[model samples]
Target: MRGGFARPVISLQHAPDLHSLRALLALLALVALSGCSLFREPPAPEPVEAPIAASEAEPAASEPEAASAPEAASEPAETPGAKPAPKKPRPPLIRRHKPAPPPPVAASAPPAPPPAPLVQTHTLERGTFRTLLDSEVRKPDGKVVGRAVDMVAGPGGKPQEVVVNLQGFMGVGDRKANFPWSAVHINTPAKTPAITLALTPAQLQTPERPKSGAPQPGSPEAGPTRLPMLDANVERANGAKVGRVVDVLLGGSADPLAVVLDVSGTLEKRRTIAADWSALHFVTKNNALEAQLEMSDQQIDASPAYANDLPVRAVSPAAPPATPAAPAAPAAPAVPAHGDQ
Candidate 1:
């Protein structure tokens, strides 16, 4: 039989080695395991959308859907471009100072009785009362009577009566008039130092005991011979030197009224003060003239100051120089005028 179709036949260029067979098997295995997808490029994945914010994701109120659901309250939304505002810090707490309450008033003191009104009082001490003796004695009408001459002390060593000398013309014909101590008001004396006399000059002149320049047989003046203690150092009962005696002033009946003391203290300045004679005692130590004042230095300083250097001695003022008499006009200048020719 004749084959019309081409007989099935094969041809090889060369026999394959063992190494080449192994390589062909590995290549066939890789091709069978892998899918066709590996041959084509992988498809690009779809992009995932990010979650939107409540302010941006929601629709505005004007939308019909948004109007149906509970309307979202309208609030201003921060723009993406603007940053959020920083929070404000709280203010610090302030503490205030409180003032203390006023002090409580003392109840027991009756709210402190309105400060007692200041009061001033003066007392008539013995030393002050005696200074009146050296002063002048005058009538109630201020009529010039005379200067106090002496003071007569009673049993208590207190002045019971005083004597004044009536000053006549030119201090001449002066007479000592006896007056009752009770009749004189030493206080309320004038600045010139004058006493008020209860009796007139005539009544005082006609005093009992003596008449017409006569001395009684037995009188106090005749009893003891006492001399004045003038220019003497005066001390106090406390042994403090007060002053020195300047002069002695007399009252009626030849008794001492007061002694003018020129005080010399720490200052060494001299000022005269009249001390009561009744309070003074004649102290003769070593035969020197000195007096011991019973009063303190304060009392002596309070006495009236004497103006005259020698107050005890009375000197009449000299008559003023006779005024010159004017000479008569020059004989009328002689009417020697032309009419006289």
Candidate 2:
């Protein structure tokens, strides 16, 4: 009986064993279910209702996490029968600036007229040319006609005529003829100095003899007016002979400006002086001609002296020497001023 009771007890223990095995089987199944849920991939997201372009798609949730994710590439869909949008006008590769207007072209001016030619003239003073005195009057063919004796002056000492002495055989038919100075040409600087006459010798001779003590007809001078210029007497107002007229200086008009005088005895110093033509008065005294000065003999001595080697200096207007004021009567000799005689 004790053995039988131990067997039943064993059986009871065995029954609890089946219960534990069942429990273990249920736990293994639960474990298997959990593992499947944990390893299973999630269901795919629902398909989107409308597709979006790559430009309009939302950005990835996390840049760092999704950086390696490949982006979906979608081509734009083209609708049939729809014209493609016109391509935008392309900007020019190189822009150009408006060219500046060309500079204004100046009109060419007319060339200036050629300038007029310049002419130069030189005027010489008198006394610079050789005196035509005693110069042989000749024709153009070198034939001597006569000798020029003197020149007769008109008013203002203008030498209007020249006296020609035609010497005949032994001075027998020697006659004088007065020709206008203009008709005579003097060339003293030539190799053979001569006075050229425009006319031949036949034109100068006359059949009629000139009256005594008279000038030839049509001569610048008549009667006693024909006097030689050189060695003519120059006297002072007091009738005292002062000097002789040695030269007659002519001007541009060939009129005598001044007469150079040889004032030899008129002053202590033997020199010359130029007297203005106006200072001289020509008169015929006793049928003789003389130039009289408006000054006295003493006044002529006070004039300036001149030299032929130097340029001429005209005589200045004579001014009287100032008389010294008489000394104040010697102060009455201080007649004995009281205390001291």
Candidate 3:
């Protein structure tokens, strides 16, 4: 075995331990530091001087107001290109209260016009009517033609026609005629007016009723004619009987002004108010016929105060019993005791 095995002789004396190597390396490093060292140390930067504060007397550059203020540690600095901060919102407004308005009023209507003052009416008796029946109707040439038996008035209350007892044997027969009121002259001043013929009596007769096939005078082919206002009874709206119209007063133009009302009753005074066209309205009730009045009895009583010859005598309390005249001074005793006879 000895012949084949050869062990290498190791140089243990020259090889270094770890601690010794460290010492050698440290020594070398010190040597390198003395010379130009492998990891060279940079020279310390030049001594930097602090910025100098400006003296009170020195003119200095202006700093912005925000930059001059002391920094707050809690707030962060703003960077370029950053979004802006949001604005505070405004408070809401308050409203005022107003009062409600009042209610509206209604408008009034205008009043109507009153009646005219120029008309009136009066009533008369049938006996007075008969007395004027036989009055003579003479012509303008002084020729006697007929006698008036009755009178007729239009609805307007003006005399329009008359019934005449024409010339016959001693005025005995019933021959009669109808004449327009304009064809006669009335002497109303004569206490009884004599109806004088201003035209021929024969010309004034009512048109004769024609044959069955003839043109009717009062038909639609002919014009309308006036109706009689005579004997039309008058009344109030409440069915109260007022009066009858006896005579009518005509104006200067021969237009009827008023009709004389015959208000014949126990306490009624015959009077006339202005009788306009409304006076022709009439009514009948319970066999009593009447012409309507536009007003009531109270209204009639309150018509304008009329003056006549009747004087208002103020009666006195009669003379206080005449005081008996002191018994005529006792007649002076006639001196009988003196025996002067």
- Where does candidate 2 clash, by residue pair? none
Give the candidate number with the greatest lDDT. 2
Question: For model 1, how does the per-residue alpha-carbon lDDT over 150-237 read when each residue is reduced to its tens digit?
Answer: 5544433344556577677798766666676678765432264546787765765534445668774222231122222434466765
**For candidate 3, what is the TM-score?**
0.35
Candidate 2 per-residue lDDT, tens place, 55-127, comes to 8866667743332333233323345888765554655555469999999999999999874322111223334
- The reply for model 3, stretches above 4 Å from the true place, is 1-136, 144-159, 174-176, 186-194, 201-227, 237-239, 250-254, 266-292, 302-341
TM-score of each: 0.31, 0.40, 0.35
What is the Cα-based lDDT of residue 145 in candidate 2? 67
Model 1 steric clash pairs: 149-250, 149-251, 150-250, 150-251, 161-181, 163-252
Winner by TM-score between candidate 3 and candidate 2:
2
Clashes of each: 6, 0, 20
